[model samples]
Every structure is written in C-alpha cells, then in structure tokens.
Target: MTTARPAPPRPTTAALKVPYRRPALLERIGEHPAGIVAACWVLLLAILCLLAPVIAPYGYNDQDLGNVLAGPSAAHWLGTDPLGRDILSRLLYGGTDAFVGIVQVTLVAVLVGLPTGIAAGYLKGAFDAVSSRLADIILALPSLIILLLLFAIDPSARTAAMITLGLLFSPSLFRIARAMSLQASQELYVRFAEVSRVRKGLIMLRHILPTALPPVVVNLSLMAAFALIIQSGLAFLNFGVLPPQASWGGMLQDAQMVISEAAWMMVPPAVAIGSLVVCFITIGDAARDIVAAATTPRRRSRRGESLEVSVGSVDAEESIVVAPSPTALLRVRGLGLSRAASGTEPAAPLVTDLGFELQPGESIGIVGESGCGKSVTTLALLGLLPANITVDRGEVVFDGEDLTTASKSRMQQLRGRRIGYVSQDPMVGLDPCYRVSNQMIETIRRHSDLSKSAASERAIELLRSVQLHEPERVMSRYPHELSGGMAQRVCIALALAGDPDVLIADEPTTSLDVTVQHGILQLLEQIKRDKGLSLILITHDLNIVPALCDKLLVLYAGDVVEHGPTLDVVTRPRHPYTRRLLDCGLHGVERGEPFPLIEGTVPHPGTWPDGCRFRARCGLATAACAEPGARAVRRDGAVIARCITVREGASEAAALVGAVRTIARPVSVIGDDPNAEEADRG
Candidate 1:
C-alpha cells in the first residue's frame, strides 16, 4: 500500500512572508528639519575648511604694509591690522589655527581620558579611588596661574597655552566619562556580555564606547570652543603668539591701544571670535538637545486618528511563504549564568540550569519577578551581558553555528541581520535627532547591500507593514514628533527591516498606554502569524502568556519553578510557587477585592535557601524540606514539582488548606474570638 508521506507537514500560517527591504539615508534625514539644518551647517563648515586656500585672496599670515589700519574697502576688506596685515587674511588663518587646536585637544582628551575614566569607573575600588583623587587634585590647582607660570618659564607662549588648556580640560573629561561608564557598566546588556564570554576590549569599544561617545562628542565641542577662547585670551594678554604673528586675541589687544584711531580693528577681530564661539555653542547645544530628545519618553500624538488596518491585505497569498522546520532552527541547552564574586565559598548561580528550544515559527514567553534573571537570560542569548557575570555552561546552536563559541565578528553579523532585538525602552533604543525613517534606514544599511533608493522604498514598505499611518509623513518626521506608540511601531519596523529569524522582545509594551499596549500586542501577534518568526518574549505580565506564547518558563528568584505548555501552566500549576503566583494575580482574586500579594521578597542570590530555593516562603515546607538540597519530583507527563513531599498527600493537602485559611482570615480578628468579645460586653 502506497501511503502519502504525511502531507509534507503543512507550512505554518503564522510566519511572515514578505520580501526583505531597507530605507535610504536621505529619505530619513528629510523627515527632520532640525537635523537637516544641523547637517547643512556642518557641511558648510567642512567645505569652508577644505577649500580655505582657494577661497582666501591672500595668505593667512601675509601682511600688506600699504594698507595698515585701513577700514572696509575693495582692496583691504574688513581693514588691515597694525602690522598692515589683511584683517580678513588673519581671520582665515586664525580660524585654521583655532580649528587645529579644537581638533587636537578634543582628540587628545577622548583618546587619553575616555578609556582611563571608563576603566576607573567600571572597575572601581583601587582604580576608581586613585582616579577620583587625582581628578580632585587637578581641579584644586589654579589653571590660569599655572598657565601664566608656564608661559613665564617657557619661551614659546603658544606651547604653554595649549599644554595648559589640555591639562585644565582633562579633569572634566574624566568626570563625564566616569559617570557615563558607571551607568552603562550596570546595565543588563553589559551583564549579558560578561556572561557570553565577550572580550573586555570588545565590550569597552563596541558596547560601552558607542553609548559613551555621543555625550563625549558634545562635551568635546564645548571644550574646543573654550580652548579657542583661552588661547585668544592669552594672546590678548601678550603672553601668546608673540611678535609679528597675529591672532584674533592679539589683534584685539593692539586695537585697544589704538581704539580711538582704529576702532575697526577691535570690532572685526572681536566679531570673528564671537561668531566662531557662537557657532560651536550652537552646534553643541543642538547635539545635546538631540541626544536628550532621543532619550526622552515620547508623548502620544493627539492629532492623529487611530488607524487599524487588517494584516492580510498588504501581501498577496502567492507572495506569503512558509517558515522552515522547527528542529532545523535554533536550540539552546543547559544554558546557565550568574553574577557573584568568586571566592573560597562556591558562588550561587543567578540563572541555574535554564534550557529551552525555539521552533522556526514558535513564540515562547519567559515570565518572572524582577531580578529573576529573565532579562539576563535573553542578554546571554544575544551575547550582551554585563562584566561582573559569568556564564558557567551553555550551548546555543543556531543554523548549524554554535553561537556560544562564535567569534565577535560572527556574532555582530548575526545580531542585526540574522537576529533582531526590540529593546524594552524604545526611548533609549532610538537616536532622537534622527527622523524615524532615518533610523530605520540606518539599520537596513548596516545589514543589507541594497542601494539608497531600494532601501528607502523598503523602509517605507516596512513602515506600512507595521501598520504605521501616513508612512511617508512619519518617515520624514523626527523621533520627537512621534508619540510613544508611534515610536514603538517604528522600532518594530526597524526590527523587521533585516527580516530576522529570531526576535527577542524585552518588555516591549511596558512604557505604552493600555490602548497602545493592546495595539502593539495585536500587531506583534499579527506579525508572528504572518512571518512564522521565532520569538523569546521577556515579560512580567502573566496575562500576556496565554494569548501570545505557546510554552512558558516561570522564573522566581533566578530559578525556574515551573515549565510546560502555556495553557497547562496557567490552568494547573504543579509547583507551589507557580500556584501562589497565579492565586495572587488579578484574575484569581474576587472582583473589587484587593488582589492577593506574594508574602516575602525574593531572596538575593547569595542568601538563597540551602534546601529548596522557595522553601522559606513555601506553605508546604516541612522538616524534610528544611533538609539540604531539594530534588525535582515528576508528576503527570512533563510537569516537575520541586517539593519533597508530593507523596505525603494528606499532610501536604492539610498544609495547603491551612495556608489558604491563614490568607483568607482577616488580621483584625486573628487569635480573637467574636464570642469572647460579646461575653466581655455582657
């Protein structure tokens, strides 16, 4: 008998099947007017510097004695200085010198100070203490006094001025770098990187450095402007750029001597200095504003109507395709990690023996309390953990590659292109100064070889796919212009830009409103159905599990208390901890009554119980439970309970009933009888 081979396992309807596309940079920049203006100004300045020689009519240092102190005229525009030098020539030359000082100082500061500060801040203890003390000492010293003294000792005033400025500015750079690095060093991503065995240098350069540099760049601009002013000030004081050498500051000094006769000299040089400083300040302020805006939580747009589009209409049935086989996708085994300083005593693990698998088109929910290691687990998967943690053992196999042992370059290639992450905080994830479209295009360009026009078309299409309204207009708008919900949608579009196989979403809806949350969830569900994408959803809200996830892993105090099908876990939790969690939820409680709350806080890793991890809070705990090292007990099918007395049915039931009764009883009447009160009254 010829049996048809099991209908060739029908393709999943859930997998998304659209063609991959990316957005263009121009399309993205076009959305934000402020970004456009900043770009133009920067471009203009760069061009001026590049073509300075051709643009200037006379040599920057050349003096024309025939037109000394001449006012604005055809032959000597903006007049000439005391030495008969073209004022315009001096301004151009002085600008070049100033630009050189700014660049040199800034480069030196970032290279010398940034790493030292990050190391001092992140390592702390001896390193931080020494750095902090040194910074303080530097701050205490009189900067100008030292400069004047150095100038008195040294014949070259310019050398003294530059050295003094560099030394004076080093302290501030150290302070800013230390603060930013300290903050980043504590993030969950950094912790993940540590556990993933990522090299220290890579972590500093790739993760910490990128996040740290933007602020440094802003600071650098301010410092550069300050440097120019200082140098010019010293020159005016007659301790800088001595003799025939003319600087804007020295010109000001000479103009003061002949103010009544040659007022034009003072005005032109002063205006030149003022204009350059203003430009630097404007650029710095704009950059700071952009970064701040990017990091700020977006407000929902009040003007737009809520647009709800069906998921099926965008792609034709023929274009929609099926996902690959589940076994052929990624598989994780015995993955565990922890954050503890190792000593003679064995360190307790934060994530103990955690293991799970993802089919090509399946979505799994990781539900847990805060500090339960849900975020850490996800970070480990993506090789993005912190520096203090260590991954003891784990094997992550994806598409024939063992990611656990994959090199940094390989991991990077996989991150945005093969695997995408939608971080919990959209505000922090996006760059604020950029238009939503521009950010989307950047991701596309980073991963794909598509042309500008093609990438842009793809970006617009992706935005439309994510159900963004007026995709073109939204693409042109800055991140500040979009609402929280809209920004999140754009984030989703970016995640989809690379057409990744696995998407890790860490609390994607935490910052969104109820309406927007529901919308985002619906959109995610729709995308999952369409793409057959594998998902690892890290969330605290258990309600989302039944609807969004097929399987659930319940984490408590860094341990997996329960694991099974989402329906079974939610309906009939075998572990006492899981049961208690469900009982404490809003759905398990009586309507209008205060929901039940878990009794005690999750113990810190070092302080976890010697017996069962949950025994201290478990109502069914007995003398046996108190005995060291509890073991797992298998019940029906794959359900495993960590309790020691599953067979002691009567005692366990009595204990559970008593615990429930204790919770149900009112505190005001505990150990006090209503009959006794009545008798006392009588």
Candidate 2:
C-alpha cells in the first residue's frame, strides 16, 4: 500500500501575490484635509527656507541705507526692516534658525526622554519614584526665568540656551512618555509577554512601544510647536541669536521699535510666527487622529441586518442538574483581584468577592458592560493577571488544585495543558512574524513529548479539525494574512493544542463582522460538544450568551448581581440590571427605532456604591440598598438576585422576579459571600 505524503507547505501569502500593503506617509496625510493643508504650509515654508539664497531678491542682511523702514513697494515687497533689508528675504532666511533650533531641541528631548521614561514606567520602584520626583522638580522651574538667568550668567552661552531649553523641555516629554508607558504596560500583550518570560527589552520594544507611540508622536508634534514659540520668545528678548543673522523673533523685536512708522515691518515676522504655529498645531491634531486610527483595533462593520441569539443545546442544559452539584470541574471562591494604591489613588478592586463554579461540560457566560471585571476574573482564574493586580482574597480551585498558591512553573504547566485561553484579538494572540504551523507546533512541543515532524503533523491536523480548507496552505501564512474569522479559528486551534478540558474565551467574537461572529460562535459550539470542553465565555453583549452558555453570570462593578441558567436569565431576568441588559437587546427594540439602553454607566473601581453595586442605576433602589454587604436573595428557590426589594417580594419587584422564575429554576447561583463554596453547598 502506497502512503500519500502530506502536501508540501504551500507558498506563503507574500509569495502568493497577496502582499500586505500600507498607505504611504504622504498618502495617509493627504487623506485628512487638515493634514494636507498643514503639510502644504510646512512644505512651502521648508522649500522657501531651504532655497532662500536662490529665491530671495537680496541678502537677508544687505543694508540699503537709502530705503530703511520702507513700506511695501515694488522694490522691496513686504517692505524693508529698520536695516533696509528686504523683509521677504529676511523672513525666508529667518526660518532656517527657527526650524534648525526646534528640530535639534525636539530630537534631543525625545532621545533623552523616551528611554528614561519607558524605563521608569516598566521598572517601577525606587528608580521610578526618584526619576518622577526629579522630573517634577525640573518642571517646576520657570522656563523663561531659567533661560534669562543662564544668559545673564554668560551672554555668549547661546548654544547653552539651546541645550538648556532642550533639557528643560525633556521633563514634559518624560511625563508624557511615562504616562503612555504606564498605559502600555497594562496592555494584555505586555502582560502575556511577561508571563511567557519573553525578554524584558523585547517586550518594551515590540509590544509596549507600538501601543505607546501614538500618544508620544502626537505630543512630539505639539512639543515642536511649543519649541518654536519659546525659541522665538527668547530671540525676541535677545537671549537666542546675535544680530547680522536675522531670527524671526529678533526681527519681531526690531520691528516693534519702528512699528509706528513702518507697520509693515511686523507683518512678515508676526504672520510667519502665527502661520507656522497654526500649521504645527493643525498637523499635530491630524497626526493624532491618524495615529489613533492606525493603532486602535478596527471593528469590522456588521453585515447582518440584525444580530439575534443563536439557539442550540448550549442555550439551555437539558439534563436536570441541581444547584451546588459536586461535579464542578473548576470552582472559584472569594476571588478578589485588586491593584495597589499608586501616588494619590486609593487601592482599587478590579474583582471584588467574586465566585463561580464551572461544572464538567458546562458553559458559563460572564456578561456585563465594560469594566465590570469579567476579563479580570478570567485572568485571576488562570493566574495570568499583571504583577500589580494581586489576587487579594481568592482561591481558584481547578481540578481539585488551588491555583492561587500555585508556583509560577506549576501554573505555566497547567495553563496551556489543562486550561486553555483565547484572547480578545486573534491578531495579538498569534505572533505576526511566525507562520501558523510554527506557533502551533511550538505550543504542542512545549506541553507534549512531540517531535518536530510529529508536532508539524499535529498542527496540520488541528487546523483541519478547526475546519480550515487546505490546512497545509494556511500553515505557512502569517496572522496578518488571515481575515479576522480565520485568525480567530487559528487561535481556537492553538488553544485546543493540548486538548484542554476547559477553554476560556475572552470576547472571542469581538471586532469580527456579524457574519464572521456567527461562524466563530458556531465553531465554538461544535468544538465544545466534540471535545466535551467546558467554556467560560466573557462578553458584554447579552444576546451572545444564550447561544453558547448553559449558565449566565451577570456582573456589575465587580459584583455578581445575578446568576442562573442562560435561557431563564434572558427570558425572565430577576435583577433590574439583568432585565435592563435584556431590554437593551432586540427583544425590546421597535422596528427601525433606536434600541433602549441602560441609563447609567458601570461604576469605576473605588467608586462602587456602598451597598449593591448596581443600586446607583437601579430604579427600585431605596434607603436599605445603600447599606454595605448586601445579601443575595433566593428567588423561586434557585436563582440569586442581590436586591432588597426582590428579597422582600415587593409588589413592584414581583413583575420582574416572577417573569424570571416562570422560565426555569437556576442550576446554580453565584452569590456575594466570600465563602461562596460553603454558601452554594448550603
């Protein structure tokens, strides 16, 4: 029997003539009208400055005593300065100094600030504290006063002024860079890189720097404008450049004396300053918009007319399971995650007194609006949270092992082997540089005793299992080559490499088009059934839960406000928050009208309400709702909703609570008690 050999790895997307293309810088700038205008102004001024000698009618300093302080005339258009030099010529020549000085100062500042600030942010502690304090002290000193003082100490220290100004300006850059760095440091990719033990420098350069660049680039453009203003101001005060050489500020200073007789003298320099400043500011704004667009994760436009819940077996468990069953594959109790106080900020909780249980083959959907700790809860469970975010009060017992106390090595062993994770964005989840098969093979090899060839075959097999046509062709393609749906499929395959029992998908369908989202969701459902994998789906949209989750966990400001079966919770929401979410969906929407939305936003950490987290937005909130440690009330002897009115079975509350219990009894209710295991067992 002849064995058919696997097809050789197909040509990559690059070789297949589907080369990735990015718009050229000029083209990108031209897309925005403001950027085009600013660019034209900058280019016009730059060309005029560069070719001043060739374009100007006369030398900048050429003195014609006969026509000093002359107004606009045929001989000297834009009029002559007090020195009889052509004003147009002087203006063109003067730009050279301003442009050169600002460029030099900006370059110096960025060079000094970028590394220092990034370092301070990533390597937080004594170095960061000391550097931040020093920067604060430096920024406190007045720039004009400092420049004047430096010039007073030594008049010939003109170059010293440039260096001093650059140094002085660096503190601002440092602050901006540091702020961007801090934000970038918190990015999922950066934290993931740290967990993977990727080199620190590589993490900062590859992951942190790219995300941080947008803000820094915007600041740099604005800083250039500020530099010009300051440079001109100093020159106006005679602290910058010496005469015979005409600077824009010096021209302004000279023109001020003769303004009464020769008003034209001030026009050229004043217009130059004003026009350039406006151009810089405009360009900065345009650049900011461009950078923001480029850096932000693009959400593919939804193609479907409407996004309705996908109904299937995952929507509701058919098996009659009682509450607090002993068959939980993963159990979490008092799972609190927090970030320590920094500077003036108080200790903030990301996940407070959270608890949940995932039964074998059960799919639980953690639904809430953004910032309700759904993602944090996932990270806390997997031991993948950032360094600063501590598991303050939690025990994540998975497969009978408490992961909170697990060593780094032990957690790493379990992460990809027993528990898999699919991140929000597939583009970030898979390294762009590596081919699809390369990442998969590496992952397979990491946890399994598979050789290179076996691992390669295994990767191909995995890709095929995920329903990719021509798996060999896809194996050689990079992340960017695949569409969002295809990339997410690849991520799913990677997550399943170890045949993990539980899959944690964090917004798996986010940023995907509606059609693609349906496909991905269908794929997840298929995989869960085939592999018998328990899934923890974290998403904000309520519609997504009913299709893929057996149970629903409704979170509000880090608190589980309601927990029950997905179908039960959706059809008859016990809590006002749960009902509000359901109302935001298509169920309550009128044809061709705006859908009703939840009124207030989720409360931020450290600002959660005293009693129930959702009380601030709850219409039924009363004086009793303001008290802390609000207890969960059992409704229909199953579903848990944390509300005093619901607990008391008030007349108004009956309408909402009664509707919920009419559908189905809750399989289990995740409650507010820190000792949630004991509470559930009761």
Give the number of the best model, judged by lDDT: 2
Model 2, 112: alpha-carbon shift in Å? 12
Q: Please write out the lDDT profile of model 2 over residues 1-682, one tens digit for every residue.
A: 2232222222121111111234345655666787778879988998899789899999989988898888888998888877788888888898988888878878888888887888888878998999999899989989889989988988657667877878888888788778878888987888898999999888778766666676777778888888889889888888767687878998998989987887778888888888888888788778776776566553332343221111111101111223454678998866767878632234667775666789889999999999899888888888888877898765788888899999999998998899999998998889988898889999999989999999999999999898889999999899889999899999999999998999999999888986687778878888998989999999988766776799888988877778878776666677888878766754323469987888878766655545567776888887766544243334433466666544433354655554443221221121223553343334
lDDT of 2: 0.76
The per-prediction CA RMSD against the true structure, in angstroms, equals 22.4, 21.7
10 residues in a row with least lDDT, candidate 2: 309-318
Candidates' lDDT values, in order?
A: 0.69, 0.76
Q: Candidate 1 — what's its lDDT?
A: 0.69
lDDT by residue for model 1 (1-682), tens: 2221221122222222222222134433343455457556645654664466888667766778887778889988788877777877666656665566666667667766788888887778998999889989988998888888888887465654675677668878888889988898988989999999998778877667666666776887788778878878877887757755656777788889889998878887787677666667666655554544444333232343232111111112111112234575777656667665421112456775565667888888888777788888888888887777777766778887888788888899899778888888887788988887778778888889988878899999999998998999999998878899988888888988889999888999999886688778878888899988988889987766666788888887766666777765665566787777656644324458886777877765544554456776888887665433243423334444455543322344654653433222211122235463233223
Model 1 clash number: 22
Estimate the TM-score of every prediction.
0.51, 0.54
The TM-score leader among the candidates is 2
Off by over 4 Å in 1: 1-328, 340-348, 588-592, 633-635, 645-682
- The total number of steric clashes, by the backbone 3 Å criterion, in model 2 comes to 1
